[model samples]
Structures are given as C-alpha cells and as structure tokens.
Target: MTYTTEIIINKPRKEIIKTFEDSSLFPHWQRGLKRSRVISGKAGEEGSKRRLYINIEGQSIKMTETIIKKNLPEEWHGQYTSKGMKSIQKNYFEALDDHKTKWTSQSEFEFSGFMKLISKLLPDMFKKRSVMVQQDFKTFIEEGKPVKTN
Candidate 1:
C-alpha cells in the first residue's frame, strides 16, 4: 500500500530538518521507540543501517533502517524492514516562509508472511500510524518538546 500525508510545521525548514536528523530526539516523537543504534556505516550517511527496537502496544518489535537518500532541508528517503513487513519512506520539506515549513511524506509498504493477513484485515492501521507519527513530529518541532512518550 502507498499513501501520502503532510503537515505544516510552524518552524523553518532548517530547524525542522535539524531536529529530524538528530537520532537522540527520535524517541521523543516516535511514541513507541524503545532504543536505536547505528549498526553499520556512519550515522546519517546514505547506506547507513540502524537497528531500532519499538514497543508497540506492549509487544516488542525490531526493525532495521537504512538511509536511502539524505538531501537535507529538501528531501530524505529511507527503507525499513521488520519481520514480515517492508516499507520505503520518501520525505520532502518545503519552506513556506521564514518561519513556517511544509512537510510531506510518501510511504509504501509491502507485507509478507503473517503480516499479509494483518494488512488485508486492517489496512487503515498503517495509514493511521503514519499520520500519527507525522503529527507527533509536528508537535515536537512546534512545541520544542515531545508530546508523546516512548
């Protein structure tokens, strides 16, 4: 499945991108994230891989993240793989003005094994999760703090 979601952040694109690139700040906006570490390559560089542990609804989920593209303040792309799901995320940022930015994301997900069944049964869940994460990031950038707990 594929979809796009967007939000307007009341901050400059540079500021938003700064926060987005900081791995230390991820746990704040990514509500379920438990821990993350770079397993190979230099952090933030294309081809770098990061392992993430997320506690989703009391279940521990693990995923490997690879940076696909890193054109900051303009675009970023990444791929994420978990047990039965794979996702590619393309993110774009546009400066609306001196103090406002527009964030857009195009996400595609493919399910296999057991997740295929879950995907068919609750397709909206993926979309909802994507939007929720975007909103959380918006709140974090605008308010200068994480609104959701990890």
Candidate 2:
C-alpha cells in the first residue's frame, strides 16, 4: 500500500528541519515511541540504522529503521522493517514563506504473513497513523505540545 500525507507547520523550514533532524526530539511527537537508539553507522547519515521500540494500545512493537537518504531541509528517505512489514518513507520539506513550512510524506508498505491480511483489511489505519504523526509534529512545533503517553 502507498499513501501520502501533508501538513503545514507554522515555523521556518530551517527551524523545522533542526527539530526534525534531532533524534532526541522524536519521542515528544511520536506518541507511542518508547525508545530510539542508533544501532550502526552514524545517526542521521545514509545507511545508519536505528532500533525503535513502541507501544500501541497494550502491544509492544519493535522496528528497525535504516536511513536511505538524508538531504536535509529538502528531503529524507528511510526504510523501516518490523516483524511482518516493511515500509519505505519519503519526506519532502518546502518553505512556503518566511514563517511557514510544508511537510509531505509518502509511504509505501509491503506486508507478509498476517500483516498482509491486516493491511488489506485496514488500509486506512496506516494512512490515519501517518496523518496523526504529522499532526502531532505540527502541534509539537507550533504549540509546544508533546504527545501524551501513559
């Protein structure tokens, strides 16, 4: 499955990129993220790998993310793999003006095993999650609101 999501952030592109590129800030916006740690290569560089632990509802999930491209303030691409799914995410950033920035995210997912059936049954779930994350990011940047986690 493939989908795209877009959001306009009320911040300069450079400011948004600064916060986006900082791994330490991820958990503030990614509601369920419990931890993120670099596993290989260099953080934020192409080919770097990171391990992400997340909790959704009552389920614990582990995912590995590998940076595919990092152009900064312009574009970034990453491949994320989990137990039965792989996702390729491409992100684009544009400066709409001096104080507004546009973020566009394209996601492609490949599922296997049970995840394949789930993907077919709940395709909108993936897209909704992406939109939620993007909205969370906008809130984080504009309103200083971090995702509330229990």
Q: How much lDDT does each candidate structure score?
A: 0.92, 0.94
Best by lDDT: 2
Runs with alpha carbons beyond 4 Å of true place in candidate 1: none
Query: How would you encode candidate 1's per-residue C-alpha lDDT over 18-58 as one tens digit per residue?
Result: 89999999988998998999999999999999999998878
Residue 61 displacement (Å), model 2: 0.7
> Residue 13 of candidate 2: its Cα lDDT?
97
lDDT of 2 at 86: 99
The local distance difference test score of model 1 is 0.92
Worst 10 residues of 2 by lDDT: 141-150
Q: What is the TM-score of each candidate against the true structure?
A: 0.96, 0.97
lDDT of 2 at 41: 99
What is candidate 2's lDDT per residue for 27-104, written digit by digit as tens?
Answer: 999989999899999889999999999997678999999999999879999999999999999999999999999999
**Candidate 1, residue 121: CA error in Å?**
0.6
